[model samples]
Target chain A: MITLNIIGSGNVAQHLISVFQQTENVVLQQIFARKREAVSHLVADAEIVTNFNDLKPANVTIISVTDGAIAEVSNALPYENQLVVHTSGSMGFETLSNKNRKGVFYPLQTFSKAKAVNFKEIPICLETEKEEDFALLERLAQSISDKVFKIGAAQRQSLHVAAVFSCNFVNHLYQLGHEICEEHNVPFDILFPLIDETADKIKTLSPKEAQTGPAIRHDQKTIEKHLAFLDDENKKAIYRLLTQSIQKNNG
Target chain B: MITLNIIGSGNVAQHLISVFQQTENVVLQQIFARKREAVSHLVADAEIVTNFNDLKPANVTIISVTDGAIAEVSNALPYENQLVVHTSGSMGFETLSNKNRKGVFYPLQTFSKAKAVNFKEIPICLETEKEEDFALLERLAQSISDKVFKIGAAQRQSLHVAAVFSCNFVNHLYQLGHEICEEHNVPFDILFPLIDETADKIKTLSPKEAQTGPAIRHDQKTIEKHLAFLDDENKKAIYRLLTQSIQKNNG
Candidate 1:
């Protein structure tokens, strides 16, 4: 059985802890959190470690902390030459202290405190400094998830940026849509099916193939009408820029 | 039975014909298409009308042509004072010829020739020039869709703009994300679950509440890193503008 110790108590950390506890052949050996109460509801007091020095050696020590604190947490680990990984998409595993055998165990899925995602579907991205540590990380990843990839640091950074566009920026667009609906006294939920289908269409067709509406069509009349309809300058600018970008890319 | 005639053979027209054919208490009396081959695969030659003058009287005639052609098609209809509706989201029923009673039967979802959507879940936004024609249009809408709203012309225009942001712009973002993934040698499918969950999250939470990532947190470091990673000038500008917009709206 593979034993694991998780550090931090943020959304990612808590989610990892919960999934690990449920997955067979994996044991949550301990959890190191600065605030014990942050994870008290998730684990017993015996499994909680408030100090980094109190962390026990496990098959893998996951530093699921903030990006800024990942280096500090790795440095503070009392043990050396152990498997230390961070669950960060943007940052590389090199940020961890070199004293430990460093690797990355980033889960390529957004985690919210309220939503419990199916662990089996999440793509676990793994990176190791040494080839020897690859097997164990892959095994741990496979135990919880059906999809796993050994992506390098450079590729991971690119994937993270792509995600910012697809997930983060897409959500921002939804917010803008919501603002428009609210200002016009229309219910935002009316757009739910359209939004859902837009995301779904890409599953069967490429985004380019699935693309519709004025921007891609370059329907100047409808474009001008939409621009005139918008009252917010920021939204108007966004509409123009994205429209131009779509035309340029697809033109 | 409520007799229906659909004028046009485009994506929206074909989808409406298919759904209306399957819906109970509705008969597709005749379909007016300039090109018979466009819809002959779905319906028999006897049911198709190439000439607008050959159209028979039905309870309602749906003009599902392109936005530019809606007015022309409506004006060409041989009958007068019949219940006529167009399915263009941006344009109002006013675009229809004055000879017929005008109404809007816009299904607020994207349609592709290849993808068959669940019509029951699609929101059909209805508007009529006269209140007397409301019941027949409402009946037609409710026959195929569970979600129906009596949205006015002005409100429908706002919803159309909102849909551009939520659906069209959102899909363009997906295209950008796909480009990034292709350039990085990472399988774009790896980001599918994240995209699905992002869309799903907003169903329960407002878009503002469901927002995540660097821009929402104002993580300047990650934001800068992403901006620098984007080699395309247009993409970089988009990242900066969208980031600024998110911060401005939320802050």
Candidate 2:
């Protein structure tokens, strides 16, 4: 059985704790939080520790903390030459202190406190500095997820940027759409099926091939009509910019 | 039974034909395509017609042609004062010739010929010039879809613009993400779970509340790093613009 100790009390940390607890082949050694009470409800009181010095030695230590705090927290780990990793998509694997065998166990999914996520489908991007540590990291990642990608720090960084475009920026576009619907006094639910279908189309067809609309067709009349309808300057600018990008990319 | 006739042989027309054939309360009277061969495979040869004069009388004659062709098609339909509707999101209800009772039956989902879509969940936006025609249109819409909205021409036009932002623009962002993953030699599947989660989150939370990532946090460091990682000038510009937009929207 792979023994794991998770550090931090954020959404990612809590999710990891819950998944690891239920995983048959894994033993959750302990959970570390700045305040033990933060994670006390997730595990036994004995398994919660406030001080880094009190962290138990385990087969793997996952530091699922904030991106900025990853370095500081990894550096503060009392033990050295142990398998230590952080769950960050943007941060480089080297950000973890050299005292421990550095690795990355980034689960590429958004975690919300209210949502119960099934870890089995989440893709865990794993990286390790040492070749020997690769097996352990892969094994640990496979224990929870069906997909485990052996990506380097550089690739992971690029993947994070791609994610920002696909997830964060796309969600922003949805926000803009939501605002437009609200202005017209139309229920936002009308857009949900379209949103879902747009996402689903890419699974079988490449996004470029799946693309459709006035922009790709270069229907200038409709484009002008849409632009005239938008009252918000920022949204108008965004619509124009993206419409141009789509035309250029597809044309 | 509600009798229906479909015009055009495009993705929307074909999908509507398939769904109407399966609907218990609906009787698909005929399908009109300039080239009968294009849609003959979908319905009985007797139900396919090349000339508008051959179109049979029906409760509704849906002109599911291109937005540009709606006026001409409806004007060409030999029948007058019949319920003739166009399946376009952006086109105003008046686009249909005044010779016929104008209405709109826009299905608000992306339809691809290669993909078999389940119409039950797709939202059908219905609009009509005559208030009395609403019940008939609603009955036709309800025969195929579970969600039907009575949207006015103005609201439907705005909703179309909103759909451009959410569906067309959002799909372009996915294209960008796919390019990024390709450059990094990372399998795009890694982002699938994240994409699904991001889409799922907005179902329960407002897009404003569901937003995450460096821009939401105002983490300038990671944002700059991501911008630098994007080598393409257009992509760089998009990254910068969207980052600013997110910051402004959330700030």
Candidate 3:
């Protein structure tokens, strides 16, 4: 069985706390938050620690704070030479204080306070400074998730950027779609199935092979009609740029 | 029973034929293809008509040809004053020849030859010249899908553009994401769960509310790191533009 201590009470920390509490082979030893009230609803008061010195040794200590605060919190840890990790996609494990055995336990999924996620489906990306510590990290990751990958720091950075494109930029497009529908008095829910299918198609086919639209078809007439229909300059610019990109990629 | 004749053997037409064949209250009368070999595998020789003049009378003749050919195919129908509709998202019902009663039967989802989609989840946007014809169109749509909307011509145009943003543009972002992973030797499948969750989150939360990442957080450090990491000028430009757009929208 693996015992873990999670720092911070943000979205990622809260989510990991909830999942690890229910995981069969894992024991959440303590939750360290700046404010005890920040995590009072998630765990018993006895399990909450507001001081770094109060933290007990666990198999792993996860710093789930914001990226900017990761280094500071890792530096503030009172103990040394024990397993310490951070749940960050953009930052590498080297950012963690070298006083402790450095590692990364980043889960490659978005966590929102408004919705609870199933940990089993989330892919855990792991990295370790000492090769011997890799086994414990993998076991910890696999206890709650079926997918565990030993990704290096460089590849993780690229994956993070790729995620920003797929998740952040894609959601922005949905917002544009919603705005268009709202302006025309059409329901935005009408596009939900299309959005769902677009995501589902990539599971079986490559995005290049699954691409379908006027942009890929090079139907200039339809493209022109669509361009003239949009009044927003931002939306129009995006439409033109993305259309050219798609055509160029296909060409 | 609502009898329908489908013209063309494209992705849309073939998918419609497959679903309508299994529909209890609908009868697919005839399928017209320029090349008899195009639709020979889908229907029997007796049901395939190469000549439009040989098209017999049906309750509705669906001209599912290319957007440029809809008018010509509808004009070529031997019989006049029969209910005729074009399956187009961009074009209105007026695109069909005035010789026949006009209507639009547009499915607001991406149809691909590589993947088969569930018709029940697809939202069918219907529009007709005569108010009475709407009932028949709705019945035909309801026979397959549960989601139906009587969108006007202008509204349907906007919906089409919205679809382009939500489905087509969104899929392009996925392609870009896949390219980033491939360049870094990271298996692209690692992002599948994240993609699925991103799509699923918006079902309950608005896209604006569900947005997460460095762009939304206004993390200049991470953004700069990402921009510096990308070697491609196209991707770098996209990252800057989208990041700016997200910030502007949130601001």
Candidate 3 differs from the real structure by a C-alpha RMSD in angstroms, to one decimal, of: 1.6
Give the per-residue lDDT of model 3 (tens digit) for B1-251. 99889998988988888788888788899889999887787774238889988899889888888888898899899888889999889998878899889999999889887699999999999999999999998999999999988998999999999999999999999999999999999999999999999999999999999889999889999999999999999889888989989999987
After superposition, the stretches of candidate 1 with alpha carbons farther than 4 Å from their true spots are none
Compute the lDDT of residue A214 as modeled in candidate 1.
Answer: 83
Chain B TM-score in each of the candidates:
0.96, 0.95, 0.96
Per-structure clash totals for the candidates: 0, 0, 0
Off by over 4 Å in 2: none
Ranked by lDDT from best down, the candidates are 1, 3, 2
- DockQ computed for model 2 against the true two-chain complex using alpha carbons: 0.80
lDDT of 1 by residue, A124-156 (tens): 899999999999999999999999999999999
Model 2 chain A lowest lDDT segment of ten: A37-46
The DockQ ranking, best first, is 3, 1, 2
lDDT of 2 at A229: 94
Cα deviation of B114, candidate 2, in Å: 0.9
TM-score quality measure for candidate 3: 0.96
lDDT of 2 by residue, B1-251 (tens): 88889999988898998888888888899899999778888885338889989987788999998788888898888888889999998888888899889899999988877788989999999998999999999999998889988988899988899999899999999999999999888888789888988888899999988888889888887888888888999999888888889988889
Candidate with the larger lDDT of 1 and 3: 1
DockQ of each: 0.85, 0.80, 0.87
